[model samples]
Target chain A: MLKIKNLFLKKDNFILGKISFEIEKNSYCVILGKTGSGKTMLLESIAGIQNPEGNLYFDGKDISNISPNKRDFGFVYQDFALFPNMSVEKNIKFSARYKKIEDEKNLFLDLIEFLQIKDILKRDIKYLSGGEKQRVAIARAIYSRPKLLLLDEPLSAVDPTFRNSIMKSLKEIVQRYNTTIIHVTHNFREASYLADKIAVMLDGQILQIGDAKDVLNSPSSIEVAKFLGFKNIFSTKILGFEQKNKFFSIDPNKIDFLKEKCLDDYCFECKIEKIMGITDHYKIFATVKDTQSFFAKIPKQIFMELKLNEGDKSYIFINKKDVVFI
Target chain B: MKDKSFLIVFLFLGSIIVLFLMVPIMNLFYSVGVNNIFETLQDKETYESIFLTLKSSFFAVLFVCFTGIPLAYLIARYNFWGKSILESLLDIPVMVPHTAAGIALLISFNHGYIGDFLSFIGLEFIDTTIGIISAMMFLSAPFLINGAKEGFKKVDIKYEHVAQTLGASKLSVFLSISLPNAKNDILNGALMMWSRGLGEFGAVVIIAYHPMVAPVLIYDKFNNFGLKFSAPVAASMILVSICLFLSIRYINNKV
Candidate 1:
């Protein structure tokens, strides 16, 4: 397990303002954030590339004062900084030798076979493609058998078409090595696919942390919800409620379009304001009697069956189970 | 059409400069003639002076390489408090007049502190081959250091960091990665130092006029027997330097 507690780092104008998290062993934790949100700085601090002014423990051992090379963590930079003078095989062998591991040749061969870059072992680094270079860099990083792996925007440099395959390869390698990885990215799809637990970061602070679906479905704060593209959130007050909860949360997908529903505990009359077709689904926008506006995404076939149009009156239903109070 | 116009201008400028540079050297060869060149080569004194010039210059270049490469790498890689001051100090020898350089060396290595100490160890720098080599090194060492520093600066420091991460020691990285990358620049610096050493006259004449290098020999011959007697040796030295320069240029191109 990797634990960072009250980690504070101040350099120039950028600050990692009081970060704390625990990454369980062999779990893939993806940090999601916009640019200049301290995602890369946090990863660097974890890797021990730069010292932070707080406590960091790896598997219950303090590594706050450890040098980067001594931290036993593998780091993949965003640029895939391969040594230009060395061949692919030599580049992979460099870190292996640095860690003083025996059987370096066998390790090199294994990595080359795993990455499927055996054919280009003798080729110089400048000749490799983006994907190929990234594979070599990953191979070099993992060859030392580091306990922790840090990836700083690995797929951000590649083309969109190659991103999925590269990410899949990286995931497979990390699993095969049983390496605990802290992957950082700005892309939502990458975060959703890779993260067992997601930490949403903004402006040098982590706004929320939970399971990927949980964070996306119900964010902890307004800024986090908006950062995650939750478009229909509003400051609402409870009205005519027997259960005296302060607030309620609902997934737009779970809200049903009906006049009379027996299963739903909450119902409201709304007028359809706008309809938008979003690939394979329809996003319905509606206003609930001068209270607040909401959006519901439903499948295209189901939306066609309803034959809903703009300015049409409708009933929106929300089940109590779908409504989470936080 | 645009390329043709550029080509015409380039050729015109090139030919004018080439003619201006070659005419004086060609005049020496024309004066020596084919028969006189062979006759001059047959002389024992000509061979002796040529051999002395080559040997002393070779030693001077060797000394420059040993000291200059590391100093240049240090200046290029590290930022210290007095780095720019040290760099300017190195340029002082190159920019100062060679006659003043020889006078400075003479005063320092002449009598008391270092000179007498060295003389007690049977190494004197007065009217000896050592004096000639010392003079040449003083005038030429700056070329090697400046060239090598520029070369080292152009190499990416990330390569060294990567090597360090890979498990190589600092010395191993310098030898395998940095040295090989800077090979061309080192060779160029050596060639510059060697050429400068060969053409040294002002300092060599002031310090060691007895062990006559080719330049000093030519000067001596011109002073005693006029231009007619010195033309053959001058032409021979010019031809040798031109060939060496061209070969170095070719090697640089190949790299």
Candidate 2:
């Protein structure tokens, strides 16, 4: 297990404000946040690149004081950070010159083959394309067979079409090597698809961390909810609730359209304000009594069957349990 | 029509400056007969003077590799009090008059406690090869230092961070990553510094006029035997400079 306790790093105007978290052995934990949210800073601190104040323990050993080389963690930077002065093969084998590898030969062959980088091993780093560079960087990082691998925005540079394959390769690497990965990115899809545990960060603080579905389905604060793109977040008073300083969030996909007003506790009549077709689904923007607006994601088949139009009145139903009060 | 006239004026002015630079050097080569050039090349004194200039300048550059590169890297990577003042001070060597610089170096190392300490260690810079090297290094060091500083600054720190995380020591990262990435600039700087050292006259004349470097030898020939005698040696030095510079640049580019 990798544990971080009250890690604080202050550099000029930016501060990684008192972060604390833990990842179980071999788990893929992702730190999800927007730009300048201290995600990369937090990862660098964990990698021992920055001298962050607090305790960092890996496998019950205090590693806070250790140098980055002695800490034995592998890092893959967002820009690939491949040694442009060396060929791809030399870059992958760079760590071998410094530290001993238990199964060097087999690991090298496996990484090259698995990452589909066998042919580009002799080429210079500047010659590779974006996707190729990404693979080469990953192969280089995991070639050392580190116990902990820290990746910063690995998929950000990759094209959308290649992300799934890269994501799959990352997952397979985790399973193969049992390397605990702490991947940092802002994309929710990446976090949702690849993360076993997700830590939602905002303003240099981790607002929520839990299982991928739990954090995505129910955010802990308004900041995290907005960052996670929760559509139906509103003041509870708009829904006739007397709770002060409280807001509720309902998932757009969970709310449904009804033909008539149902007897559900959270049922209300709303006018269809706008219907936006998004790939395979349509987004329904509805306003309850022309005051409380909510967005619902309807499947294409359901949207076609309902034949909903703009300014049309319809009853929308929300399950009481789906309303997350924050 | 305005753009056309502007282009014509620019091209005409550019050609005039190019010719201004090229004409004197070309005329010197043209005036020196092939027989005179061959005679100067075969002259033992001229050959030794040129050799001394090349050797001393090269040693100066080698010494800078040890002293200047680390200082440049430190200045590039870190920020501390008086850093701006230190950077400005580094450029002072270039801005000062070379003869005055030689006088300063002479005084600091010749008459003071520094001279006593050096003399106690059986070392002296007066009219010695050490004097020649000191003069060259004092005047030409800014080229290499500034080049290295800018080169190191251009290299992203991410490379070093990634290397450390990959289990390489800080020294290893600097040697394998930082140094190699910044090499072109550093090499360019060294070349410029060596070139500047090869042509140095004022400082070298002040410190070591007896053991004549090529520039001092040319000056001596001009003063004693007029332009007719010095022209062959000067032309020879220029030829050597051009050949060496072109060859090194070609090799650096190929690598």
Candidate 3:
């Protein structure tokens, strides 16, 4: 329902461009990137709130040059941007005052009730907590029932407990309303959980865009894989693959975790370099045979059982079938 | 206590200035009883001068609102090549000698294209109520503009962006979101402009001395009949100033 083609933007020394993506009707698209990756700039460009050299098509209309007010898009800022002068109800009602999509009140009631902001509807914005402010901001944005919803790091400032519930409610609300969404965040976990299609952006360009699992499991390049924090990314030739596709590969099945250094089967002695915590999983980086460094993603139980620490010696088992050509 | 010596030093330094300011106003109040101020208010000329002062200053604030808000919004939100220069220029009226401002205004607005063009339009400023208002607005506009700029600066621009994405036009976002959020500072600016305009003397006297405001009338009374004649008018002006000051303080606290 929404397509951005060859979007180019230059702000000072930072440039973002050729950002092309399409979101299906009612689909959730997440723009994932690191800090200063121009993620928010791309979102603002698509929202038509910033100047960009590109074209955007929504519902078969070229809306590249239209004002933001005519875009029929909802935006949730990272800061929530709740109107301090208005109560929660009035802030939500403020958006409604500008545009009326239909002669319907049930949707507004559902939003207010489902977002769990009805209790604080009469309270001033200053008195609300961070989570409460986010709720109100979303309610205000959705009350207008815009065709597209653009969220710029909506979960960044939210408490962890509220973040999960907010994501769940947002997904449910989007499905119920049949609204397309594009969310920009530097957090991969949020993207993995919330996006139907994940677009990985680095610097100013998009490196990969596909299903969340596809991007995570097999990134297009080692750079993309490294950025996505894939544990094992290296240039290893596959035994049976054609010469054209044998150069880039990943070991899909995790390497075996060894408590003591043992050279048995496809085993190599290595020194632990770093351990990155990924939610409940653990990613261990170790140098193999003092020549090459490789990382292994193991279950937290296996990692704890081995009790590995940085700079400690360890061994890992690898198999031929574990290699997957990207 | 650890703070005792610091507290004593602070009190000693602060009380001297406080007493220096309070002594004259208190002595003025002691000399002019409430009966004198009340009798002065009974005079038609005293009432008209005070009323004219308020009326002109109110009109001055209205003019400032018309011309100053957009400039303030620009200064607060955008940066341009000469933005800093423009901001400093706005403050020049506040720093310049009022008598010099009067002389400059009188010369530029005296039978020149601007003055004659305005005269042809039947809106003369020389020795007229229009001149008083013009002088008041020229002298007081910086306050309103500066205060409003500070107010607009405090409002996060993200709200306007979000409002626009939520389908609010630029004007709608400004009116509904920006204005109401900055209402306190805007009101403060208006009060400052009005109060400053009410007390304007040098420019107003040079431009429109015949139709006197409260300050000009007191000055005239002092020059013609010495201290005794002007004391009651001064007391009445102080009473009005105190009332306005108290009301502003009360509203500020509530806000």
Candidate 4:
């Protein structure tokens, strides 16, 4: 396990605010944030590339003063960061040599085979494609068998199709090595797919931390909810609780779509504004009472059967359990 | 179709500039026949001057490479107090006239302060080969440093970080990655510095008048003997510089 406590790193005019977190052994933690939210800085601190003004511990040992080479953590940067002067095989072997490992050639060959870069072993780094370079970088990082892995936007620079395959490969590598990973990204889909726990950061502060689904489904604040694509969030007074403070909440994905009118207390009439066909479902947008707009996803077959169109009027029955108050 | 008038105007101006630059050197070569060139090659003074110039300039380039590369890397990679000041200071040698550079060297190395202290310890700079190397180094080292720094800056720092994470020490990363990657710029800088050192006249004349380099020897020959006596040596130096410059360009292409 790795633990970071009360870390405050100041660089120029930007300050990475006091932050703390722990990564359990063999677990994948994804840090989600927008651009310039100090996600990279935090990861660099953990990797010992950027020294923070606090303590860091690995397996209950204090590592705050350890040098980057002594940290024993594999760090993969966004740009792959392969040495341009070395060939593919030499690049992978450099770290293994530094760690003074026996049977270095066999280990390097194993990694090259695992990453499927065997044919390019003799090729210079300048000749490798983007995906190949990233694979080489990953192979080099894991060559020393580091205790933890830190990846900063590993798939952000690749094509969308390549992103899926690379992420899957990375997940398999982490699992096979039983290495704890702290991955950072701004893409919600990657976070939802890879993270065992998610930490949402904004303006240098971690705004929320919880399970990925919990953070996505019920954010702690209107800003986080909006950032997570909660479309129907509102700041309003409860109908019967006049003395209570004004609260903000969102309609969850459990809200049901209605084809015809029904006598229900938890139903609201709405006009269909837009309909979008997604991979497995259709996203339906409706404006309720001309004041609130909500989005819902239904099965594509049901959507085709109903044949919903724009400007159509309908009622959406939102379950009370589906409404989250923040 | 191209406009005949504009084409004529451009070609006319270009020809004039090219002639203005090449005529003096061409006149030197024309003045020295093939027989005179062969005869001058056997002259002991001519060989000594050429050898001294090449030797001193080579040493000056070596010194610049030793000191300038690390300074460039530091400026390119790190942020520290007075970084901008240090960057501007690097241009000081380039902007100052070589005559003034020579005068500054004379004052610092003369028997007043540093010169006296150094002499007490057994090192001398006045009228020595070391003085010639120093003068050439002062006026030309900045070109090397600035060029190499720009090259290193273009390389991604993540490469070094990756090397570090791979277990390579800091020095190993520099040797294995940074030096090889910046080889082109380093070579270019060395070429510029060496060529500049060879052509340096004012500073070397002030610091070391005896054991003359090619530029100072050319000036001495012209003043004492005549243009006719200096023409062969000047042509020889120009020919050698052209060959060196072309080789540098070729290497740059390969890199």
Candidate 5:
């Protein structure tokens, strides 16, 4: 288990303010955040690479001021900072040598096969392709069987096509090693697929940290909603209770009742400014209050059936209970 | 000149500079023929001075390897207080006049607290081999430190962190990751410092002139008997230096 209490770090002019969170042992935790959100900095601090001014309890020990070598945390960089001077075999051997485990060789072989990196073991690091390098990095990190595997945007440098395969490989590796992981990334898709817990970090502070579904379906604030790629959002007060999208089916009974008074509830009143779509899908861009814009995606059939056009007034209702007020 | 003939201008300027450098060495060889160089090499004093020069410079670089490498690594990796000042201090030997550096080293080694401490240990600097090595080190250390520092800077700190996380100790990470990665740069720096130490006359002459290095001997011979007597010794020294330099370059490039 890893517990960070009121972690504070001041790097250059950016301050990672009083961030606090925890992850259970052998669980997959993804600190989901945008770039420059101090995600990498926080990881370094936990890995003991950076001296953080806060309490870091790992497996019931206070490791706030310990050095990185003693932390026994496996950290993978985005660039895969593999030892270029050492060939693949040497790199893995160099790391595994420290374990001096009786079964290190067997364990290494298992990881190589599981991560699908056995083919590149004899090649120099420079000779390996980008995806190959990524696998090698992951394999090397697991070679020592680190207590907590901390990956900083591990797939950011790999080919986009290889991302899905690598994610599956990560799950297999985690299960095999039973290692606690804190994977930092900015993509929700990755979080949804990999994380047992998702921590939404924005502007240097974790705004919300919960189950992946909880954080995604109900983001705490507008900033987080936007970060999660949410559009067509108006004030909870202006949107009545209904998790409705312009796309797909709309309940006629609910639509008629949504047109009724929902003053105290969250409902959005807007004028359609423009419509954009081809084929079955349509995007309705609308003006809410003077300058604020809200966009929704609906089916082209719905647009034609309703005879919707520019300047048409519309309303998107959000159920009061579902309206997340931050 | 037009851009089309830029190569002509570049080649012409490069040839002039190359010729300017080679002409003097060529003149030295012509002045002292191979027979004269062999005759100078046969002289015990000429051989001994050249040997002493190589020996002192070698020890000086050895000392640089021990002290300078760690200091360079620290400067490259950490941001402690006075880091910028310490970095600037490493360049002091290169920036100051060689004679001024000799004078500064002289007082520090010959008198005061440090000099007394050394003497207490029976390591006097005045007219001693230790003095020659110390003077050479003082004049040439910047080359090693600056070179190693540049190499260390180019090595990403991420590798060090990864190595540490892989259950390697700090020293082990440095040896296994940082040192090997920066080996070429550090060796280049060591070579530069070694060559610079070979040519150090101003500092070594003041501290220990009795056990003369090659450059000091050449200067002394020129003062006593003019160019004719010293040219052969100078030519031999240059030949020996060029041979060692080429051999090192060959090994370095091969590696």
Candidate 6:
């Protein structure tokens, strides 16, 4: 369990926080933000690598002023900072040399085997590929069986094809070790897939923090909604809702072409302006009476069956349950 | 056509300097008779001077390693007041004329308060092995310190951060991570310092002229005798120096 309260960090002109958040024990917490949003800075502050001006509690122990080495946390850098002077095996065993790790040999073996880095155990770090380096770095970090693990863009350097498998392995590592994880990434897909809790960070503050599903389904503000890729956000007055000074957003995938109105469906007429083909779906951009525009992500199969074309008149339907008021 | 002409001109200019460096050393070999070179090698005084040069330079490098490494690490890792000024100050010895550097060393360690203190403690630099080592250390220390500083600079701070998070103490991380990562540069610096110390003349000559290092002995030979007598010693020193330098470099590269 980790609690960061009013954590403040300043490096030159860049300041991060007044940040307050808590992660449940053994839960995966993802800090999601764009580049230069102080995501890494916050992670470093939590790791005690950067001196921060607030209280940090781990398992109810105030560890704000503890040295990084004494925090018993493992950090995986974005660049997979493996020791260049050591072989993969030696790197994995490095923490064992300094700490009194029980079952050190078994932990080392399990990590290398689980991370699939056993083959390169004798190879120098310089000869490894980026993906291989990442695996080794992970193996080295997990070998110590640390209580908490901080990952900075762990899969950014891996090939896209291997990312899913690596993510699965990371989750499995957390589960098996019972290690609380704080993963920092800009990719919403990664956060949606891996996080139990999500913290949306912008500039130097946490804009929203909650259960991943809650944050995903109902963003707290327009900024958070836009960041989560909500495509249909409009003032309630434009949509004719009774609510004033309120904005509502609907997930693109939830909006559909209407045939007949259902009891809970909100229906409106729009003309298709443009249709763009994505990987496995079509994104239909439509304008409501040539005023407010919105895009809907329609499944390729459904779009093919409907046989819709640009500039065609269509009815857009959204269920009341899908509308999120912000 | 113009590029080709410019290339030719550059090559011509480069070759002149290359030849300038090579010709004199080659002439030393050519002018010295083989028997004289063998005789110089066999001579007790000549070999002793060469041995003294090697020993003094080795000790100088040892001293630099102990004192300069921590300073280099500080300069590389931290930003504090007068950091740039401190870095510039380290290079002053290289810029100062060797004779002036010799005078400065003499005034500081042999004739000044430090000298008096050292003498009171039953240690004196004048005309002693310690004097030779002090002179060598004074002139060659900058090379090692600067080299090590640049080396430490090149090591990514992320590695150290990660090492610390892996439960390595500050000292452990430095010893296992920082120092080993900067090994090549430190080695190169030591070699440069040692090589520089081997050829030091002006400072060592002023400090200790009796227990002659190779350079001082060569100067003494050339001054007291003629070119004919000194050529063999110079040739012998050069051959040994080249052989030692090349062998160490080869070993360093292989490792």
Per-model clash counts, in order, read 3, 0, 0, 0, 14, 0
Best by lDDT: 2
Chain B TM-score for each model? 0.94, 0.96, 0.95, 0.90, 0.96, 0.93
Q: DockQ of every model listed? A: 0.26, 0.89, 0.79, 0.78, 0.73, 0.82
DockQ of 5: 0.73
Q: List model 1 lDDT by residue over B199-232, tens digit each.
A: 9998888889987889989999999999998999
Q: How would you encode candidate 4's per-residue C-alpha lDDT over B3-68 as one tens digit per residue?
A: 998899999999999999999878777779767776776789987888799899999999888899
Cα lDDT listed for each candidate = 0.82, 0.92, 0.85, 0.84, 0.83, 0.90
Model 5 TM-score, all chains together: 0.91
Model 5 chain A poorest 10 in a row by lDDT: A248-257
Residue A80, model 2: lDDT of: 92
| Cand. 4 Cα-lDDT | 0.84
Off by over 4 Å in 4: A235-265, A269-290, A296-314, A324-326, B1-20, B248-255
Q: What is the interface RMSD of each candidate, in Å?
A: 3.0, 0.7, 0.9, 1.0, 1.2, 0.6
State the lDDT of candidate 2 residue by residue for A42-63, as single tens digits.
9899999999999999999999
- Stretches off by above 4 angstroms in model 3 are A237-253, A257-286, A295-316, A324-326, B248-255
Docking class of 6: high
Candidate 2 regions exceeding 4 Å error are: A238-242, A253-261, A269-286, A289-291, A297-315, B1-11
Candidate 3 CAPRI category: medium
CAPRI-style docking class of model 1 based on DockQ: acceptable
Which run of 10 residues does model 2 chain B get worst, by summed lDDT? B33-42
Please provide, for model 6 over B1-255, each residue's C-alpha lDDT reduced to its tens digit, 9 standing for 90 to 100: 999999999999999999999999998898996777888999999999999999999999999999999899999999999999999999998888888888887898877688899999988888999989998999999999999998999999999999999889988998999999999999999999999999999988888997999998888888999787788999999888889989999998888
Candidate 3 lDDT over B137-235, as tens digits, reads 888999999999999999999888988987889889889888887878888899999999999999999999979999999999999999999999999
CA shift at A89, candidate 5, in angstroms? Answer: 1.3
Off by over 4 Å in 5: A239-270, A288-293, A313-326, B1-4
Predicted complex 1: DockQ: 0.26
> Quick one: ranking by DockQ, best first?
2, 6, 3, 4, 5, 1
Taking all chains together, the TM-score of candidate 6 against the true structure is 0.92
- Measured by DockQ, the strongest candidate is 2
How would you order the candidates by TM-score, starting with the best? Answer: 2, 6, 5, 3, 4, 1
